[model samples]
Target: MNKFLFKVSFIILFLFLGTAKTFAQKLKFLIPDAGIVQHAGSIGYFSVGAGYEIFKNKKGYLDFNYGYVPAFKGGELHAVTVKLAYKPFEIKLSDWAKLYPFNPGFFLSYTFQEDLAYKFHSSEYPRGYYYWSPALRPHLSFSNEIELSIPESWDGLGINKIGLYTEFNTNDFYIVNYLQNTSSLSLSDIFQLGIGVRLKF
Candidate 1:
């Protein structure tokens, strides 16, 4: 009876170990692949975010960001953004460096402000009272970034690469204004510039 019990316990222990390993693998898949921080670019004065390369070959990324604008700078704006980007081309500079010449993306931002009111229901206003919501902005962007691959010696730091990027962005409201007042509003007036860093793990 003792020998039979020992065999059964060993089998159960082996099954538990297998299940735990599978769970760990799934959890690892959910971990973010990169982190980003940026300044300016229409979302806010500054933002911090995390992202994952959702596609193979690093072709696409989905990021979530929180942004802030100080009262002195804007009006103490707070926003959350979800951005999806596509990068289709890469130039390999060396074994340790690569350049992505074009990355085009779109983002949706939701703003939070105490003094401003956003009407969600049509009953709050007559037809076409306001064409757009002040609290929600949809933006289009184009950006380029360079990646510097880290050596394996730095693996302990958990960072595999570092990237520097610059972005130009414009929102739907800006585009509409530009279209309506093309003679007065220059293309430059509708666009904003942003710079940031990305760390890949």
Candidate 2:
């Protein structure tokens, strides 16, 4: 509770102090999070991102975000990794339901810096180089998420939304084969269970 309040306060303070004279729209802040499915164990991560939804005249909306997710340099090896997503789902969930593909969402993101391999057993693997070359770097990701929201959960604005992201598809990863303690592949792709909140206008 304390942490949530502090973040909310910071968001409000920055929203006004940073860009008060920019536009005429309700300021929306989001705290998005999800659990990582791992072979060893699962860990939770949270990201704080705030952006404006540019409402068009009788049309769609445009949104932007800037945030970061932190973790151990080897956290990616222990079944945990963070992704920055720029999600642009339909503003009206109910309206989209009437269309094909049922409930859906898609996002584009770039990682500031991601852990590619783990330095297991302290000295079991060399620690001189911790990250793979950007060419072989598997830190960046572009994953599209789609979820089925239970009826009556959304008032059409996507606010106070609750649903299950029963489908997840992220098939991109960068692990170096020649790198020590790092394999040719890491457990990042495939579908998993997900739950998130959408505070939209």
- Candidate 2, position 165, lDDT: 25
Q: Can you tell me which runs of candidate 1 are displaced by over 4 Å?
A: 1-24, 117-125
**122-197, model 1: which lDDT tens digit per residue?**
6667867888887888999999999999999999999999999999999999999999999999999999999998
lDDT of 2 by residue, 1-201 (tens): 999999999999889876764543343223322222211111223333332333343122222333333356333222223333343333334643311223333334333334432232346557555443221222322233233443464566544322222224332332233233344444452333333333432
Q: Can you give the TM-score per candidate against the true fold? A: 0.85, 0.30
Evaluate model 1: give its lDDT: 0.90
lDDT score, candidate 2, position 4: 100
lDDT, residue 178, candidate 2: 24
* Clashing residue pairs for model 2: 138-174
